[model samples]
Target: MEAPQQTEKKRIKVGIPRALHFYRYFPFWKKLLEELDAEIVISPLTNKKIVEVGVTHGFGELCIPVKIYYGQLLRLVKDHPDLDFIFVPRYVSEVKDSYFCPKFLSLPDVIKILPGIPKILNFEVNVKEFPISTAAVELGKQLGKGQNKALNAYKEAQKYFDEYHAFLREGASVNQALRLVQIIRPFTLPKKKSEGDIRFLLLGHGYNIFDTFINLDFQKKLKDQGVNHITIENLPESIFKTPVIVNPRGAKLQNYWRHEEEIMQAIRYFLTKGRDEIDGVIFLISFACGPDSLIAELIMRDMKVVGLPFLEIIMDEHSGEAGLLTRVESFVEMIRRKKKGLTVGRRNKLTIKSA
Candidate 1:
């Protein structure tokens, strides 16, 4: 008998935008898709053209990060026209009583308005209602995977995800960790902080903090200046998970927003236990972000009480590199002066009482 011709299995190609949650949960997504024999296509890094496209197309009231997300999705649609599906999970709530920002909840539906976009492979991720594995299994089923296969993929993805976070806790930048875990190709490694004289606690959502293009390469500039900084991601999970007392009235504020809660907890931890470790704080928040506005006021008040230097940089599409550089350079110099007991006089208008 003639040998039967072998049928080649068609690989599903899924596009993932390199924005927002990609900074946080990419490794898990990458692993899951790979296990299901899907070819993953990530949009290029943020650039001027991408920003312009996003701003032109995105809703007026949406924050810059969400706008950038729109840009990334459009890039995938325009550049990879043959993509089978675009993965845009609805991240409603990760923990009980705490939820993602409103934009995230509506992301999938909002992005569908863009013309010529590929089919969106979406699933709800509300840990309060069901485990992520349940969602992952359903996602796999959509890709024609068996329940056992999907569950196995989830287990593998979880393992890789934990390892990725472990790398972060060990002082790797998100890019570095992603590269180490083989999700992304190698790039120029970040400068080591071994000899830096000052340390700042950099606070922001991962999307804002890690996307160098949008943030105008803020972290790189700090590193180049030999100024060390730590982000909320670098700290151990236990520290940020601890509940925080946001005000002196002992009225424990339960922040319902997930990222804001982490930021608040991190600020509290630094204020109480890690006070000496950091010289100052640089909070990068998006313009017109409701949660950020509320949290920013509380952070400023808390930092003022502790007499720790704090600088809040508000970002939007119009944020210029020159202005950001000026502010960052001035903040670093001020911190250095404060640390050295050099007089930062009234002329400079730095109102934060020296620690």
Candidate 2:
């Protein structure tokens, strides 16, 4: 479902695709634009129709997240054409521990393939020893906010951003961000009420977790089960600091392959840190992701012998709701039974029951 409108304001409405780096930078975006005195309108979470629309417009081989974004772009144009401008930030390379996989870098370029994308307020950032504030100034210039207004906005935005992240760094969850804003958050992290605090590791590209539909109410199920799972977005970029080493030649995400490598390293970290605490691993991958295919194979092989109870689900625009729910149910039951020390049974099979 779409989020309820906040207020009728004359401020510019910026459409943000709830994908890719949305989670990592939303607080920043929120702070920046609020400083710019513009209103933020986030695209609704990914869903079946949205996914299909994306596939219809996107390159055949792109991952599901990109397609979901395309669909969202179309919907925004059709539904809110009156908006001032839609944002499509241009980011290339690893900005600290946060890395934009190749596809993310290619997003603005791909917009030409789809019709009706509004004027994009871009803040393109590539490695060149330039300060992010300069880019923000350029963006301000484009928005017709006099250089001074833009400068002030950028300064205030940066300050708010530091404060926002400081709260999170202090162990505040997403809910805390909303609380600070005095807005009711749309989602919640699963509480620790679940017995024995059964834990599982969530593996997926950052885009998927933040998008609600593409993952098929996955969060609700976890919340319902009181399951505590750790998503990529849940971890701060600083976590990937000097402690977590990437590939020697460079685990640079030239493509999805490198993205998978980064995830693998994270898996190794989680496994080593909470081996006894984590009950199993649930990996979420787009239907056509190449890097994920290889990573899935590796995860299965590594977990199979050790009986780690692995579950992998594919998210395509066409993936059904019922099937997705069933798959999760099976995974949960499998873990529950194992916790009871029951007799061994065939498990680890993909349990998506499509309608």
Number of the top TM-score candidate: 1
Number of clashes found in candidate 1: 0
Error of 2 at 111 (Å): 1.2
User: Which 10 successive residues of model 2 have the least lDDT summed?
Assistant: 184-193
The numbered model that scores best in lDDT is: 1
| Weakest lDDT window of 10 consecutive positions for candidate 1 | 180-189
**Residue 37, model 2, lDDT:** 72
lDDT of 2 by residue, 247-302 (tens): 34767433224356567765665555546657888888887777687778877876
Tens digit of lDDT per residue, candidate 1, span 36-92? 889998998899999899999987889999999989999988999999999999999
| TM-scores, one per candidate | 0.91, 0.76
Off by over 4 Å in 1: 1-6, 182-194, 245-251, 344-355
Each candidate's lDDT (Cα)?
0.87, 0.69
Clashing pairs in 1: none
How many clashes would you count in candidate 2? 1
Candidate 2 wrong stretches, greater than 4 Å: 1-11, 96-99, 146-152, 162-197, 236-238, 243-262, 297-307, 344-355
lDDT of 1: 0.87
